[model samples]
Target: MTSDTEEQEDELLALHSIFGSDEFVRDESKSAGELRVCVELPAAFMVALTEGETLSQYEISFLPPLLLTFELPEDYPSSSPPSFTLTCSWLTHTQLSALSAQLTDLYQATGGAVVLFSWAQFLKEDALRFLDIDTLLELPSGEHSTQNCSQDSLDVALSEAKNNKHTPATGPTDIQSLDLSALSLEAEQTLQTSEIKADYQDDQSKQISKEDFLNEGSVLLPSSSSGPLDESEQGAASLPRESPPNEDQRLSGRSLTPSQALLSQILIYDAAQQQKQFATTVFDCGVCFMGLLGMDCVQLLCGHIFCRTCLSQFCKLQITEGNVQGVTCPDADCDAAPTPAQVRSLVGEELFSRYDRLLLQKTLDCMPDVVYCPRHSCGSAVIWDKSSTAAMCTVCAFAFCVTCKKTYHGTEACQKKKKKIMTENDAEQPTAAVPRSQEGMKALWDDYVSGSKQRKRLLESIYGRRSLQNGLVECLSEEWVATNSENCPYCYSSIQKDGGCNVMRCYWCKRLFCWSCFAKLPSQGYLDHFDNGTCNHFGSDFFPAT
Candidate 1:
């Protein structure tokens, strides 16, 4: 014959194999265990707050599970049933008492057989249906001390059913399923402090209301027009009257309602479960097009997934090419960039450092009040001063004028350019000023014109506003003439070629020249220049039509 201990061991082993660690826990030494029974929700059921004037409903796919804790006695299943408690946050005290009675009745119907699994199945699959809650579950307000009442009823009902053999016990009123007495000393102290704070808040709110009422009603009466009131009238008037609490005060001191508290628990549980499912599932990488488990891939902030190897290679290429901006989502339609931490994980510290440096440089280039130190060896960033054109490099201790990019010379015209502080050998060499590239000049001009009023004024203070205006006009004129005409080789004056073949006459000098080569052509045989292969009479090299 099978012993009661053997039957208990076999059932526990089967349960451990069926449920994951998240749902079931067993205490082998005490012959006790706990199971979290997650009731199945229907397709479109809603949960709502019961006391609100406006209906506040939420569509949820899952709720926090009901905790069922049980302990088996020495007697076999043929003699006695397991002692247990069913606890949930969303159910009312009345509902909990009814369910506790039904569970006892279920054990009686089982005829001394093991009824643990049967009760769990009933809670998971048919609890809501049995309670006649088809579409919605309404939660009570904070005014209901439902958990205390439910605890008492549970104790009475279980004690009567077992004939005082054993009584069921409940846990606290949160998502956790541990006895309140088992809480740590620190947690108990925290609870006490929170209660004291709540009481203080209530007292402060009442005092503020009383003071406001007295200020509004205590107006001085003129002795000539009105006689003094009796002592009873003054005493009655001094007593505080009831009124609605201030909106800000009410919100700051108000505790969450029971329905709100339960709703928050349900939402938190649903999100956690969804994340756990996502982590273990398989997904297709968007970049490499490889099917891989989520543990081997990376999910970006934009919700795109790619294998780590592919993302590493992509980021490495971007950093190598100095195209730091391209280190973003590989999806053509999405422009979301990976976070610095994610990028660091993929490309490693070395490449991520390079990416960080280049990104910072690009950002500083866009700011009007930032510039780089002129020393070639130490190209550190320097913050520009609004009051003066001179800036000092914090890294190299080099002070230079911002406008001319040379050593600072206070109130003096800028000198001829010298070689940038490169090697110590080249630092003192006198070098011609390098002309700015077309792109560099355009970027600088854009920064000056499209900058804020303060930035524009700062630039104007350093370089006179009239000088800057003339420089702009000169830049525009040079661009226009360079596009429309050629310059005279001798006088350096612009000469437009309107008509005639390859032969041109400068209006300023009356000198004949080959329009194609701009070579000084002889007045007698100016057409001879085109006869040679060096120049073309009607080739695409002629000035573009206006």
Candidate 2:
């Protein structure tokens, strides 16, 4: 079974034991009074939280539909082990109060002692609603084999598929045959090529090369620093390691580039900085500065140093009463609020663990149960009873008569249902099928988005090319508009050229000018003549045409 399913079973077993007897309701065979619980969580809740996901430094809240379960004792008045569930989508103040009351009632009625122990404490936030309910279709117990085979199959498939985009191996080495611990570091590699050789001289040269290379060079992974890098310290990160020694000079007698040499130095520096956030801060001789045999000394902002015991008392007494400002350094006449590091150390491992739990609780304070709608048109509230012979919809009252979602309402009938309805609607819908409207909408949306992106890219390229062309033309031309008046300036007549060239003579005055351009010439004494042009008509050399 999956871990989630196994966890579910464990929770139910815990609830059964908590009720005081294995044979519930005085029946050895029947297990109704055993008080089993099941919770249906969303697929997103599949991930088990990592240690990094938690923040323990402050007051927090949690949101959830996590399923929790407990079994109630049969004999209530004499010896009661009270347990109940409060089902809601969200946690209001009233719901929280009611839950607290239920816990209180369970304790008060049962001689102020917990007869029931909490072996299973947490479930995913959304699964809490069906905590005390039954189920249909229990998951198989073959998850161990399935889980093991899944990784191998995925690795093989990923290795073989040419179309896959994701880098399945995450590194150059093939993961299927790799054993990380057995791999040894290579020492004899030199990156210097002919191109790089031109840039760097041997140690024997006087003046070093000054030109910067445009190449991306080698991958410069972040290395350990003499002091912790500010970004690395924020989130948990390991220190960097040194580069392996170059074997090019030692083994093959190959040359190395200056870039490679610099990279090695950087790696070495980072490796040296690995174990430390900063350099060791040594203090001079003083009675107060002395490290005690039992506990370490923590220095406050006021420069007062004290043992852990002093800080804990200050938080409990001063901070608890909301008078933390009044809390100060225990040393004579100095006052300072306690530092977080000091407070954490003072609290110690046990209290820190508790605080961490509280922090998780606060972060996940009141999330409600959420499940996807099983129907095509509607995503409605549908309870999943895994153990049942068939799934019945509460909202539509449509009953599925088969485990495979086929309705056997006529000839085939399960032990659970008394009345069977045979209809097309009551039959189970295929998992792959989507509602017509949803399918249509999805296609339309996809097409629209894809078309929009292609158009945008096309326009951007066109605009970019035009902009470059415009820049060159702007430099070459003086005034872009009306620089050339393509008409006769003397008579204000339209000009046209019909010949192979631009030169033209006016028909009226036989004026020497370009028929295509009636504007003044940039240089002096450039006469225009054209055999074919509108300006070349019957004309005298000195006469002006009316």
Candidate 3:
């Protein structure tokens, strides 16, 4: 037969294999071998309780650690069983008693076989199911109160078992009532060492028996009595108890209330339908023209779908290059653009902020009545009334003209000020002595040329130099019209008598007019006007020589 020491080593090795060495704590100061351990309930059982419900922090706090203290007897496994005590903060006294009874029964059923490992495994894996703890609220109170299981209960039993030197391990007796003292010296020294803190104690005032909780006729109370049931707790009672059909067929098929059953069926159908739809779906990306799953593709408002990878890359490229407006549907002919929310979802927060700012700036730039402060130090956008010509910057308090984007001149038009500058420059110019008529004409021409130059410079300062140069080209276009064309008296369109008779028709207004005096002519033609001698220079050049 194996010696007790060798058997103890083998049992400990087995426990290490099952629970890991970190979970097994041996007291170094004790010659009578003793160990303390902590274990978690299995995930398969926890999932059943948590399914279809979002647990709050308070509800999750009730999941306390299971602490066990055990001592090895000197006798062989063939004659004696290990003396053990189980304690938990989240289970009531009756629940703990029931668990102790079940554990004792399990050991006896094995005919005095070594059963500590089996007992730990059962408590870790099957205790929740055995006690029907189907929800978080059904868990025992976790408040500080006298009803909590005292650690002294376990210590007293351990002390008695240690004193009874001849006590046999094999007996039909109540383990809860059996005051066995089999703890080692180290355990006796640390009997009160692992006491639960005051805050960690269960709220015994709200404690309910397991029977009352599981009873169908009893109305379950909230976890606290200080107030009525909250929305979560009220809805929690109606939630269906979901478990895999194969794992526990009876529990899985347990009948739900009418409303709960309908909800369960709806959820099942929606999940199945979505799975079927997605399985059958194939998305062809518009950008890369690659086939992908429905989930891999993003659909724009234009009803065009592209793979998320391609769309995200497209958006990032456009935003990086400051081409935010170009971040639209990739289709060559489509004009649809993604919304701000869509861009945010695709490009992430940092890049989306850039895109949004660029988009807003572009929009403000297009508004005629909106102008950014001309001061480079304070280039904040400012809005003016459409009818007003100036605006005051809200941020910098800088007043500026909306038209010229210069300093604001109240009640004065920017163009009127520019014209006044040109007139003043002309008045200051010195006139050299010359013949009377010739000098007057020469001075007029010189002043006209100087005035044009001054106007060009003023426009250049208001607009950019390049923009003013383009405007000069347009302004010079009027010269061509003045030289080769005469204005239609009716519509004021410059009508060029290009190789046609003096009876000219305005292309814009289509009315007949005399090229000589620019007067509306009879419908008959210029021949009738000449016949009546309405104006001179009929047969010759219609416009008299200037």
Give the Cα error of residue 440 in candidate 3, in Å.
58
lDDT of 1 by residue, 87-167 (tens): 565776556556665766676677767777888888899889888888898766543222311222334344443453222
TM values, all candidates: 0.47, 0.16, 0.34
Give Cα distance to truth, residue 502, candidate 2, Å: 99
Whole-model lDDT per candidate: 0.60, 0.33, 0.51
lDDT of 3 at 160: 57
Query: Which candidate has the top score in lDDT?
Result: 1
Candidate 2 lDDT (Cα, 0 to 1): 0.33
Q: Candidate order by lDDT, highest to lowest? A: 1, 3, 2
Candidate with better TM-score, 1 vs 3: 1
Better of 2 and 3 by lDDT: 3
| Candidate 1: pairs in clash | none
Residue ranges of candidate 3 with Cα displaced over 4 Å: 20-65, 76-89, 139-376, 379-546
